[model samples]
Target: MLDAAQEKTFQNDILDKIQSHGWLLGESNKLNKQLVLYPEDVIAFAKAT
Candidate 1:
């Protein structure tokens, strides 16, 4: 689990990347109601990868 500060930093980094790139598709875990980066996001990261 991330501490408060770590969580904030992590969220900021994600927001920055999304702003620079495009929208990311996230998958939601119904059990915990937590969202995670989806496979589609990884594929969208790079075209040559």
Candidate 2:
């Protein structure tokens, strides 16, 4: 399990990245989730979920 400080550091890093790069983090998450989804359906599913 992660310690409190490690978890806080991870969250801070994610927040910092999101603040610096407008929605790229969300997009990357969408892309990662789509790895198991159909190629043509990825975008639609990404937006829906």
Candidate 3:
């Protein structure tokens, strides 16, 4: 399992990738909110992005 610092860095990395690609939209924000409670979704979203 990732430490808190690593988890935060991972989340920021995902967010940065989304922002850098200009792919974030309303639905993506909703998905990100879901990610806070369901971290596994991050991997799926990252793959999709």
Candidate 4:
């Protein structure tokens, strides 16, 4: 299990990986949830591969 600081580091690592793979990150539009979504192009790319 990760401590608070270690958890932050892990999150950053995952985000970096996502960006490096051409995935997107952004704030959610709905008030009920907060999240980042990987855009459709990333899914298309993966399907093509």
Candidate 5:
């Protein structure tokens, strides 16, 4: 189990690696998105069948 400082450091290191990979960090507008999954698609599919 990591302490607070260690956890922060690990998170930063992971983010740095992700940025280096050139996909998630700079490619994104800013930070992680707050995504939500609505049931609309499932409901629509069920209705169709």
Candidate 6:
């Protein structure tokens, strides 16, 4: 398990990568605790990076 600081850094890195590729990062839903990403967004991200 990640420590608090490690988790924060990991999240920040993911957020930065997503935003850098012009993709939105949705908040995790309470029920599933998963972040939402559209299929096209992922494709675009893949092509961009």
Specify the highest-lDDT model's number. Answer: 6
Candidate 5: regions farther than 4 A off: 24-49
lDDT digits (tens) for residues 1-49 of candidate 2: 8899999999989899888976433444435464654454566778899
Model 3 lDDT per residue over 1-49, tens place: 9999999999889988998998553454444463453355566788899
How many residue-pair clashes does candidate 2 contain?
0
- Lowest-lDDT window of 10 residues in candidate 1? 25-34
User: Candidate 4's residue-wise lDDT over 1-49, tens digit each?
Assistant: 8999999999999999999999766555522333344455457779999
Instruction: Put down candidate 5 lDDT per residue, 2-45, tens digits, no spaces.
Output: 99999999989999898788834333443245543234544667
What CA root-mean-square deviation does each model show from the true structure? 7.6, 7.1, 9.7, 6.3, 9.1, 7.0
Candidate 6 TM-score over all chains jointly = 0.46
lDDT of 3: 0.70
CA lDDT, every prediction? Answer: 0.66, 0.68, 0.70, 0.72, 0.67, 0.74
Q: Which ten residues in a row have the lowest lDDT in candidate 4?
A: 29-38
Report the C-alpha lDDT of model 6 over 1-49, residue by residue, as the tens digit. 9999999999999999999999766654422325445556567789999
Per-model TM-score on C-alpha atoms = 0.43, 0.42, 0.46, 0.55, 0.48, 0.46
lDDT of candidate 4 vs native?
A: 0.72
Top candidate (TM-score): 4
Candidate 3 has what TM-score? 0.46
Whole-model lDDT, model 2: 0.68
lDDT of 4 at 39: 52
In model 6, what are the clashing residue pairs, if there are any? Answer: none
